[model samples]
Target: MLVRINPASCPSDGHLAALTGERAFCSEFKYRRGMEIFGEGEDAEYVYQITSGAVRTCKMLPDGRRHINSFHLPGDMFGFENGATHRFNAEAIIETTVRITRRRNVLDAMTSREKGAMNLIGFVTQNLQHAENRMLLLGRKTSLEKVAAFLLEMDQRQDHPDMMILPMNRRDIGDYLGLTLETVSRALSILRDQNLLRLGGATQRRVELLDRDELARLDA
Candidate 1:
């Protein structure tokens, strides 16, 4: 099943206000590409929802390597922490705008409304499922398999299904998949030469899956 986030389709303030009996305490903030939104171990005072553009949540290793946990596209909600501190550092993958609300306010609102609590539970459950699937992908997939899987995921997540325009860079992809940047590039080249996909666009971020069945077989 293909699933994508669309900010335009997100519930308006009215719907949320109806459920919680309180208006959402939201404020819009903009960040330039590569700007840090929040740092690891920082206080988790707020929950964030993407209004436009993309964000990457990552952690820095002791060896100074970066490990990307996930990408937050438009309409995606993130920054839910189990404790007071953030576990990952979040940054803008491109010029982005996000709506942020105080975590305490959300919890207080949910406490009064059963529907709101259930919605929050469902949202967190979906994120956990995605994390589990990624764990499996990273642990056992081959280099080519990983790249194919990543492309398929991007296709499913993007606003456009026919043409995939990735927002993140090769380094980000490598970090997410536990591969080197060179490995990721080589895999894409191999796939293109095999006629499984066509890569276009100035930065080669746009792709069209030529033989999706073959790509899926490779991913499997």
Candidate 2:
């Protein structure tokens, strides 16, 4: 579940290495399924990269209801913010490994290198685009459309074209799509009834899309 690394994967050319020293590359950790990586309002000490598995960033309402914002899979970076504390909590949806770099070290690297600043800007910009898309999904899309969009997005992340493995559950899906769990379940059932998808098991990890065209149309 939890792992620590003294030296981590870095750019081979030693460019980033020269800027951040070997010590900066330390502190990689692995989290168990449903493990909390960081808590809301916790000090923003480091930024993380998903080395394996998946993570979900979410927030809780005053009444203790959770709303999942997004899911991050391998190669995705998260927990990077220009603030003293994290705005949301990050938890592993499944077993996950993440590489971390101290916030101060990252800032120092950016300060010394224009390219570093640019790269950080680009990362933030991409995240902003994703957030904007989610906002649109939440504000305008119907329940069916939202589920369709979620499926398509998950499909893109999958390795096999014919199958997709969802890491999170229906409740998490509902929260992310701005629907209730019953609504999410109903939409998925409709998709199945229409022969658009075949669910593999109760976990809903394996799904085969039988009608991508129809699914795409639902999003329109």
Candidate 3:
């Protein structure tokens, strides 16, 4: 249920247009790293799809700790809400571009041609499923297990060849994985030392999973 909302008529755009029967219904916007896309408690008037880079959706707890609900990478959608207002804040993790359309327009368009509403259903289902899985993973997993699971999740989502490029940094990964930044780094270093994976690139974001089965065993 990903939406690649490029302004040009790419294959993703064509697929969406076929579903909604409306061509060129969305507009694109760009945000710099750390820029706020939308804030918590704001009106949920639109739906957004990332064109490039990444965005983090999060909320602050009473203790001032931020818990990240999810990350939206290129070709993924966000900004859907159950109520009139947004429950969490959304910010660009890097220089990112996103296409957006009015929620009402989406509903009206679905009412017409895409009676299946499979896109919306699938999107919502995945969101719920991810949340449920994270609740368990965060509650009981050790630092090594959490980081290993994180790598596996990113590998599945990004579909890169042998190497996985991470867009977010250590602090962002810590926030999402419920660990301290040092703990995240230490876990990755341990995995690299064990030859379960190798971290490369100038920023060390390029990750090659050497033994996915071992990572899976730890995750299990």
Candidate 4:
């Protein structure tokens, strides 16, 4: 889906203009659930910001096995790899809207201001930290611990005080956690059995935490 920024809420008029360029060139393109945003090895000409919904980035092995690298939610940015082409495929997990900006414009803006460069560096560093954490999660954490860690991270990111709404499904979670779909479902069942989480409705959108401290301990 096409997304446009309201001029009033933008960080800076000049920056916004530079980012969007001449007219509001914004267009909304809708993607059905599981639609590909961009494929692996495609030219990375544009950087994307999630306007609504969620997107999953994944790499696939020659044998057709998939490993999800991360999920990008509203306001999250992706497709900013420095190389000419993207290394992974990005797909929308639900109906989604994304604001697109040409990479050349962003690079030019960074060249004009040291602050822009700093911001880009900070963004890259944050992504690196998340990658390291995921590496730890997949390489060492137990199945239960991985699920617990995932919930805790989602809670922190979404800042849901009473209940957390998951935007992705079991298969997406499984690919991310390096487990099968059945494993992810079983892990959620185990958490529910332990009274650590309450699943609401058939969609599994509502998730209430019963014990924050216990969840943290499991993360540890």
Candidate 5:
């Protein structure tokens, strides 16, 4: 979903480049770990591109459940809405920096710059594909399978190939995968025991896929 907002209506933050009448300039801002970038139902005034670190976008249910929609990594873009307000909350999963531009400016560029427009389409396509895959993971996969697939995903997204340094904690992973934190922890322990992965780091955020092929088979 995409939201379009007038640049003049927003606050005069130095982080907003469109305030200076630039066509596509963006200003960088820093977000501390666990800081909320935007909240559900808030005005969708900016489109953000992550320069470093990671972010999680999630929806809160009336019963206080959270369903994480996606995790945005460095070089990833997020915070789009189909209406005037956002439907989910976005927060930094780690200390992060992002460059933000007005949604209006980005929308204007979509029509004027061919390359920019193509990039938007490509990014949207990727999100759609990811959503489909996630649906399958949530609806059909078992607890073990879901955890395996998630580890593989983080491994790939972290771009370390076979090893991963997870930025989010067990509760976040549980919420994203529709499992209890105990379940998530148990699955990782089981995988470790099976020689599928090796956990390092004091907090166990560092994980090395010991047998990628076996993990892939387990995920399948």
Candidate 6:
């Protein structure tokens, strides 16, 4: 099921262009849920910034296991790469809209090579930081800790402070957090039982953090 995202105020075209950082070079595109935005090993010709929906960056192993690297919400950027081809696959987790700019167009539109390079470095560093955090979560965190950290991370990303309408399923979460499906479900149930979080809505994708401090402790 798709989770509805309600932005406080929608931005105009001008604002969107500014947000994309490519101005006139940017074009809008929409993708249906489960659509492949870009595939692994494809040419990294364009960079994308989410306009309103969620997306996921993933990798498929030789044995056919899927590993989700990151979940991108509105305003998050993806597809920026230093290499000629994308290292991982990118897919729309929900109905999505994005402002996309071709690599050559972005370079041509830049005022200076220095500024463009700086911008690229910034994006790379941001991505690196997230990757580092996720590495820690997977390498050292216990199942409960992993799930707690995932919730806190998603809580911060979602529009609401205490509530989150998760765009992905438990299986998706498990893949991202390096946990099994049963372990993910069990962790969530444990959190709910401890009164640290509450599952709401008919679909139960709506999660409300009832005790953030306690949850933080668990994550810690």
- Highest TM-score: which candidate? 3
Shift in Å, residue 117, candidate 4? 1.6
Question: What TM-scores do the predictions have?
Answer: 0.88, 0.86, 0.89, 0.86, 0.86, 0.85
Give residue 208's lDDT in candidate 6 (0 to 100): 89
* CA lDDT for candidate 1: 0.83
- Tens-place lDDT per residue, model 2, 1-220, is 5767546655311223333444345456889999999999999988777777899999998987888888998867678777889999999999988777777776786677757766666767777898888888899999999999999888876754777878888999998887899999999999999999999977876889998889889987
TM-score of 6: 0.85
lDDT of 3 by residue, 101-217 (tens): 777866787776645388657667777899888998899999999999999999888884498999999888999999999999999999999999999999899999999999999
Q: Higher-TM-score candidate among 3 and 4?
A: 3
How do the residues 1-220 of candidate 6 rate in per-residue lDDT, one tens digit apiece?
3333432333324323333343445567778899888999999998777887899999988888899988988877778777999999999988998767677765564545446566655666777888899888999999999999999888877754757889898999999988889999999999999988899887678998998888889888
What TM-score does prediction 3 earn? 0.89
Model 5 off-target regions past 4 Å? 1-23
Better of 1 and 2 by TM-score: 1
lDDT, model 5: 0.80
lDDT of 5 at 215: 82
Q: Rate the local accuracy (lDDT) of all candidates.
A: 0.83, 0.80, 0.83, 0.79, 0.80, 0.79
Q: State each candidate's clash count.
A: 0, 0, 0, 4, 1, 0
Write model 5 residue lDDT over 1-220, tens digit each, in one string. 1222333322322222222223355666778888888999999998887777899999888899988988888767788887999889999999888777778877775666546556666767877999899999999999999999998888787775655888889999999999999999999999999988899899899899988788889888
What is the lDDT, from 0 to 100, of the residue 141 in candidate 6?
90
- The Cα RMSD in angstroms, rounded to one decimal, for candidate 4 relative to the true structure is 4.0
